[model samples]
Target: MYVTFVGHVIEWRGPAPFYFVRVPEDECAGIQEVASAATYGWGVIPVSARIGEIDFSTSLFPKDGGYLLPIKNAVRKPQNLSAGDEVTVEMTVRL
Candidate 1:
């Protein structure tokens, strides 16, 4: 499944800090409908994601009844992205 959405980059402070984009509610609902088929354990859905010209593979993390798409540092530096910057993400789910 292919989906695209614009979201802001946000920082999550866990054991280590990380950046992510929260999937919009409507889009999250759409993913949830097919999540059982696509998700591994813990509701993680594998997907190939692209932001600007950067492409990478990662899992959508379930949080607060939604999903957070991790934005890798490698993708961020070249793109000059930081927390609070709005980014458009294209994702292809591997079912």
Candidate 2:
């Protein structure tokens, strides 16, 4: 299925780097940073894969009031992602 997720980069940690994205209305997902580069003075990271399984039970509220959700087995990095950068992501949800 094609799903559109709009969230902000909340946290980026670990050696491989994982993005903790916060969607609207307290929804969130993790997008693994696969590749990154500076383009036109803007940092652009290409998240080419998803992780784990899509489960709603892992949802929680961020300290800032937004919901926190894991991107399962995210295959991307979480660097340069700030805590409020409006992001529109398109991905294929698999079962």
TM-score of each: 0.95, 0.34
lDDT tens digits, residue span 1-95, model 1: 88999999999899998999999998898899889999989989999999999999999999999999999999998999999999999998889
Cα lDDT computed for each candidate against the true fold: 0.94, 0.38
Q: Please tell me which predicted candidate would have the highest TM-score against the true structure.
A: 1
Q: Which residue segments of model 2 deviate by more than 4 Å?
A: 12-18, 23-79
Q: How accurate is candidate 2 locally (lDDT)?
A: 0.38
TM-score of 1: 0.95
